[model samples]
Structures are given as C-alpha cells and as structure tokens.
Target: MESARDKRTGEIVDAEQLWIINPVDPMGYECRGCSAQATPCSYRPENKVRPYFSAKDGHNAGCDVEGEVALVKRARKQRVTIREGFPGSFPNRLVLRDTRPVSSPDGSPTAPSSDGGRRTGSNGSSERCRNRHWAAQTIRPICRTFINYPFDRDLPLVVPGVTADTYQHVFRSLKSDQVIQYPEPRLFYAPISWKASIADDDRLEIQLSYGEWKERKLTRPYRVRMDWTDWSAAKRNYVSREIETARSEYMTAKKRGDKEKGWLFFIGRQDESDSTLFHVDDHRLVCCVVNEVIYP
Candidate 1:
C-alpha cells in the first residue's frame, strides 16, 4: 500500500512522511488495511522503486492496495493506437483558415485565424466540432485530408507495442503533408529546449521556440512531469540514460558555437493550471530527443 492511515492522528500517512518518522523506532502509525502494524519501505532513489507501506505480518488477505492494477488502468486510459495504413486508409477532412501575419498597433505578436475547424469524412461532418468565429478578410478555406490522432487529457500520446517502423511511417506521412498541423487548444506538441533544474511545481522546464505556436508567443518555459510508473522497466532505464547523454551532447555543442541544438519532441494535453504555460505528463508516447528520433 502506498498510503496508510495514522493510528494516532487518524490522518493518511504517505511514505515520505513516514520516512522522517524513523522506521527503526516505534511510530504511532499502522496499516489501514487489517489493522496490522505497518512500516515505511523504500529503495534507493536510483533503484526507481515506488515507496509503499508494508505490514509486519507481510501479505494479508484482501489487502486492497490497488498498486499495479491502478497503474494498468491509468495507462489503458491514455493509450493511443494508430492502426496500420492509418492516414491513407482512414482520411479526415479538415477546414483550415488562411492566417495572415498582422502586427498589432504597438507591434505586438500577430493573431492567428480563429477558424481551424476539422471534420471527419468517414463519419460525416458532424463527427467533430467546428470553430464558429472568423474574420471577413480571410483567404478561401482550403480543405485537406488529415490523420485523426487520439490524445488523452494530461497524458502524453503513447503508442504501446508499436514498432519503430510504424512510428517512422506515421511521422513521415505527417511531415509530408504541409496542411497537417499539431493539435490545438486541448492538445499541442512542439520541439523544446530543457533547463537543468526543475520549476516550482517540481517538474522539468522546457522552452518552445518562436513561430511554433500560433495563438501565443510562448516566451516563457513550460513545466513537465514524467510519470515513470507508466513506462515498462526496460523503457524507463533506456529513456533516463538517453536523456543524460543528450543533455551532455547539447551542452558541448553549444560551447563549441555549433548551430546544432538538442530538441525534445513532446506531445501532450496542455495544463489548465496556468494560462501561459503547458504541462507534459506522458513521457513514453510523445517525448524523445530530436536527434534520437530522426536518426533512429
């Protein structure tokens, strides 16, 4: 169990709180399950083990800990599947507004056209919502076929059990189509530069470059939190090592005045907590170093 109720205070006690309670000594907390005595348990941080409460009696009948079951359910909800012959076989009709770059009176950033509505041809026009408002001075709407991608709230776009060849095919198809853009409003993805330290939210900070975002400048860096439990043990190890190596290489390249910049590709639901910032929680699906992705 990751949490247990305090026998004395009647409050829920987490593993970190109990860590300071001196596990070797008697602490006034016990497992909420079965009323058995509980102890705080954790492995070294490098071991990447999630902390949990352990009963003195070991495994008990019907412990109700949810642990792995909860994780599986969470991952299942966020899973994304791009079927074989995805875009080619299944085409989507999207209405894109012609955006003209116009400076504000005070030379502020340009505003994009409000009409970037999308619809599905296979399911008919009513399958998705359309943006209603638009300006009079706009170009004729250009209709294009786009691949429909599934995205989950607060979760990254993960393609489970997908081969690299399939991913490459999808990426190449999206790249070839000039009209296809990243998901908007509820979803977004971009190339970013990472900061060494985490932000106040205890998440990593990443910066999006200019001209990437249409509505906002994204001048400030966004925060991201990686949920390692969503990933398989082997993938977690690989991603960690690759990140370190990529960061080192990026720093070295910068010092040498090379134009090469290490970019991380991230796709996830934007954070509603801040108006100007975005958050990434799905590291397995939509997160990767640009070089690693392009080369691999």
Candidate 2:
C-alpha cells in the first residue's frame, strides 16, 4: 500500500515513511483503502521484498495503492539495475536499494499462473509484493556530509544495510526552498545499548559510557539537542519510549546485582557546531532516519 492512516494517532503514513520503523506494532495502523486494520509486512534489511502493508481482512474495491494498480506499476518498472558508475567527491554515502519482491525458494517467479497473472491469495497482498518482479537491485546513494545539497556523484564509502535513497525523494517530499546539509555519522543498532538524558534547557542528549565513547573515537561523550521543531510527534514519542525503556532496563539490571553502562545511540543530526562542541540538528534533512519514522 502507498499510504495508510494510523488508527490510533490519525496520521497518514506512506511506504517511504514506514521503512525507518520496521516491525512496528501492526495493530496501531489500518489500511487507508477500506479502513480495515492493517498489518505491516516488511522484509528484512537483506531481503528484496519492499516493505508494505496488508489488510488484516481484505482489500476493499476502491483501494487505490493495492491489487491491480500496484501490479501494473510493478510490472512497468520491472527491475532496478545499477551499473558501476563514476565515484563522486563525497567519500561516504548512505545506500538505498529499490524494493523488489522476494523470489521463491525454487528460483522461479512467484506470480500466480492462474487468473491471467492477477495476484491471488488473501487479498492478493502477498502476490502483489512477490509476483513477476525481477531480482536485479539498484543502489542509490546519498551524501553523508552536512551540505545543503545531496552529492550528484557516487562515492566509495557506502553505508551497508542502510536503505536511504537519493535526497531527491526526501527533498521533493519536504518541498522546501532551502534545506540544511545532513551529516552521516556512525549508526548503531539495538545491541549497543543507548542512554539518553534531558537537560534543564530541554536539550536531549544521548551518549555512551565515557570509556566506550573514547574508544569509539567520539570527540564528545554527549550529543547536543536539535531544534524542537525538527522533531515529529512520532519521532519524539519513539525517542521518549526508547529512553524510558533504557532506564527501565538499567534499573532492572541494577536490581539483579548486575552493573552495566546503558547503551547510547545517536539521534537527530550531527552538524558542524563550534570546534569544541559536536553539533547536531533535528531538521528533516539532518535527521533523515528519524524524519521517516516520525513523519507521515
């Protein structure tokens, strides 16, 4: 599905927006088509199937982004193929792959032979995502520096498993006359453990343990706050939840007589502040990951 409204929050979420917060609580969302409850069917980062939503019941007759429409669109694009291209100026880049359907284990296409290539099986959701799609993948690159514009050329330092497309899509979505450049710093997943603290100024800072931060080559132990307006309600809520969860885990571990430093992950953007301070911003361009997860 292209987009759906959140049943709980009444927010409109699209496929591009869903990628950041994969494995979300399925019950919180519903299909925009029929207003039926929706379940997110996202592929693993390594999988080719583009993440999508499926109606818990079935698609309605008037669904715009599903069924035949989706099939026709997928069939027309057929495949995304990227060839070796010139390397650009920006050394580091985030790589995003075009979403494709997962192939069958038998190495055959999964599009149903019945119904004249029309998708089948449970509202045809599975069929739509899987059938008649080519296996070829394309890698689109986005610059990692804190520049106002995305790099027109590709680079060697590509961040693996980070599905970020060229900034063109994001820029188009923002529809802004000017945008800040976003810096691509290190990205850490859940296993690293993240800790967050709120200062009196309402600045949200996240950090690792002092020793760990030093070992990781972090010049500063803490991340400064981005402008509050840069955050989406969804992103703010998720950050709050993650912070609370981290605190809860810390207390639980302490009660168990285990001493451990909580894990800390970076949020918002990392911009060039004063030479002494590590600067970060919360604008959509700077915090691309958070923007997708939080915004519609």
Candidate 3:
C-alpha cells in the first residue's frame, strides 16, 4: 500500500515519509481499511525498491481497501462527468497541518479513502458515497490522482495560495527554456534531468528535461532552486535522499526496457529576474515521482 494509518497517532502517513522519520516505529502501523497489521518494506536507504506497506497476514474479508483498488481500475475505464461526479474517490484538497491531531471529530483520520467511501446501486454498479472528497496531508496523493485521471482533469481541487479551482487549471507544465511571464503562481511540474542536478548544503539545483538541446546535449534547461539555508539537517537529508532514490528508480526501469521518467512537482513562484528559474523553500511543497505515465 502507498499509505497506512499510524496506530500511535492515528495519522495516515505516506510510505515515502519513512525517509524523513529518524526512528520509525516498527509496530505502529495498520491497514487503513481493516484492523490488519501492516509492515513497512524497503524503507532503508540501501533498498532499491520504493517504500510501501504490506499486510503481514493478509487482509480481512471484504476489506474496503482491497475492494477500493478494483473500484479505481473500473472507474478508470469509465467516463466521468461533472454532473455525475468522479467515478472514484479522490483527494479534492491539500491540507498541511503543523501538528498531528489524534483524530477528526468523526474519529477518523483525514486521509482520503482508496474507494472514496463507495457503495452499490440497485443495478450493482458502484455508486458515489455521500462523502466523496477527502483531505490530503501531502501533495503526492494529489499528484497521483492528477496523473491517473487525465480524462477527468476538470475535477475540482483546492490548494492554498493557488487561485485555480480545477485540476486542469491547477497544474502547469514548464515549457523548454522559456522565460515567459507567469502572471499567477500554480503547481508546476517538469521531467527531471539527472545529468544536471546538484545537491549541497546550501541548496538543491535541479535541471528539468525541457531545455535547449544541441548535438544531443542540453545547453540550457529550466531549473528548480530549493533554498535549504533555514532547513534542519534531517530535512535537508530527506530531500537529497528522495532525489537520489528517484534517479536510481528511473535508471533501473530504463535498464529493464520500461518507459519511465522522474517528475518533480512543486508549488512555487517563477523568478522575477530569471523566468526559467523557480524558487521553492518548503519541503512539504515538493515531491518526486518515477513512473512511465503515472505515479503514486
């Protein structure tokens, strides 16, 4: 599973977050859908595979999470409309909470459900639940939904500081080596260029795939500059490790003849002086995903 509920705090945490935690609690995780024990896997720095949670003894019968995966696949095959709403559950908003609460008023974590709290209709077709949208603690899940449901780009979304309402308008792609004026800030993403990335104590400079290419060499590329001057050592290490892991995953997929690319997603403003440059400071606002056409 991409995420699991922390029994200690009742907060649903993304598997990728394991990198940031100095000491992970071995027995503090459980399945989000059932009372099954979940084990963290491949979370060590040396592990080549991405981190994820696995049920130790398998899930209970009729586990909501198990059924939710199937529902997502079925929804992907169907068409979506604004009137009918999204066929499956999705994180409709991003909520960055400074402190982790024990639980919400309903005694449930704010993390989104895999199935969007689905039910069956008279004809046995999956029907939307009353609570369709859920809150997300990180941008990773939102980015995954954005990539998974390309056809449903018109779905509504709410991100703090961003003016756009729909997914289509919220995400903006960086064009190659362009210094165009950006009147408004949005969640921008670009393919990572492994050859031109820099990581140091001062900051991280990442070159995007889109850039000036000549004789098969990228002469100039769009870059993201993350200021780490005020960040803690642990926070800085987490970002560095994430980038390295993404590069490794991308190379492994290429060696296996898989079509995969590493994408960097962040919500930041364009450089007023250098339009090709974007400055990001918050660690929570940035994420890296490696996939063929979609990501988790």
How large an RMSD does model 2 have? 15.8
- Clash tally for model 2: 8
Residue pairs in collision within model 3: none
What local distance difference test score does each model get? 0.37, 0.38, 0.75
lDDT tens string, model 3, 1-296?
87776765555578888878768887778776665788888888788777899897998775666566766565456545458656555678988887775545665446434324435889998543444466777888788777766667788999999999998899987775554667888888888886757878788988788866688866667888888899998888787778878887877787899877788899877788877788988888888888655421
Regarding lDDT, does 1 or 2 come out ahead?
2
lDDT of 2 by residue, 63-166 (tens): 54355454333433332123644211122433233333344565323542211232356854533222221111111112112121223222233344334433
**Local error of candidate 2 at residue 195 (angstroms):** 8.0
In model 1, where do residues sit more than 4 Å from their true spots? 1-191, 197-219, 228-237, 290-296
TM-score for candidate 1, residues paired by index: 0.30
lDDT of 1 by residue, 1-296 (tens): 54554544333444433323433234444554344577666623453344457776764554434233453344334433345322111111122223324545653224432223223667464221222222211010100001112221211122222222222222321121122233442223333455563433234454444222434533444443454445555444444543554566667777887755555444344455553345454433333332211231
Ranking by lDDT: 3, 2, 1
TM-score leader:
3
